[model samples]
Target: MKAFRLEELEAQRAANQGAYLQFLRERNMSVGLYALDAGQADPQQPHGQDEVYFVVSGRASVTVGDETETVARGSVVYVPAGVVHRFHHITEDLKVLVVFSPPES
Candidate 1:
C-alpha cells in the first residue's frame, strides 16, 4: 500500500516551483495535484487521455467544449479525450486532484 500526505506533497510542489505534482503512476492510471491561484489562468490544453478532476478546494468554473459549470470543493468532473476544457474566472484559489486514465503520455 502507498500513502501520500497532502501537506508534504504541497511542500514538495512549492519547492519544485511547478504547478503540478504527480504522486502516483501506473500502467492504467495516474494521479497528480494541480494548483492555481485565484484569478490565474489555466495553462493547459486538451489531453489525449480521459481525465477526471476532483476539486479539493476553491471556487471556479470549467468549460468543457461549449458547456461551462461551476466547481468547488467536493466537485467531480469528467472530460473525455481530445476535448477542450479549462477552468476560468477563478474566484478562489483551487487545488484539484487530477486522475488520468491510460496513464497520460
Candidate 2:
C-alpha cells in the first residue's frame, strides 16, 4: 500500500505555492490539499465532477449553491457536480482535504 504523510504534502504545497495541491489521482477519484489564509478569498469556479471537502483545520464558511454553512476541523461537506461553491469569511487559516469523483478533468 502507498502511504502519504501530511507534512510531506504541506511541503509540496509550499513549493507549488498554489491554493490547491493535488496529491493523488486515480481513475475513480482525485485527492488534494486546499488551503486558504484568514480573510483570503477562494477563487475556484464550479467543477464538473462531484466533490467532497473535509476540513482539516481552522474555521470558515462555505457557500454551496444557494446555501451557506460554517465549517471547522472535522467538518465534511458534499457538493454535487456543476454546483457553485466556495469558502469565505475565513476566521482562521483553513486547511481542507478535497476529493473529486471520477477524477478531475
Candidate 3:
C-alpha cells in the first residue's frame, strides 16, 4: 500500500500556483494536498471533474456557486464538475486534502 505524510507534501512545491502537491493518481481517482497562506487569494476556477475537499487545517470561507460557508479543520466540502468555486477570506493558513473522481487528467 502507498502512504503519504501531509507534512512532507506541504514541503513540496505547489503545482497549482498556491502550493498544491499532487501525491496520488489512481485509475479512478486523484488526490492532492493544497496549502494557501492566510492573506493569499485562491486562484482556482471551475473544475472538469467532481471533487471533494477535506479541510486538514486552518480556516477560510469557501464559495461554491452562489453559496458561501466558513470551513475549518475536519470540515468537508463537495463541488460538482464545472461549477464555480473558490476559497477566500482566509483567517489562517489553510491546508486542504483534495480528491478528484475519474482522476484529473
Cα-based lDDT for every prediction: 0.94, 0.95, 0.91
Worst 10 residues of 1 by lDDT: 5-14
lDDT of 1 by residue, 1-105 (tens): 989988898888879988899889999999999999999999999999999999999999999999999999999999999999999999999999999998878
What tens-digit string does per-residue lDDT give for candidate 3 at 1-105? 998877668767453454687789999999988888998899998989999999999999999999999999999999999999999999999999999997887
Q: How many clashing residue pairs, candidate 2?
A: 0
Once superposed on the true structure, which residue ranges of model 3 sit more than 4 Å away at CA?
14-18
Answer with 2 or 3, whichever has the higher TM-score.
2
Q: After superposition, how far is residue 4 of candidate 3 from its true place, in Å?
A: 0.9
Q: Can you tell me which runs of candidate 2 are displaced by over 4 Å?
A: none
> TM-score order of candidates, best first?
2, 1, 3
lDDT for model 1 comes to 0.94
Model 2 over residues 6-82: C-alpha lDDT tens digits?
A: 88998899899898899999989999999999999999899999999999999999999999999999999999999
> Which stretches of model 1 miss by more than 4 angstroms?
none
Which scores higher on lDDT, 2 or 3? Answer: 2
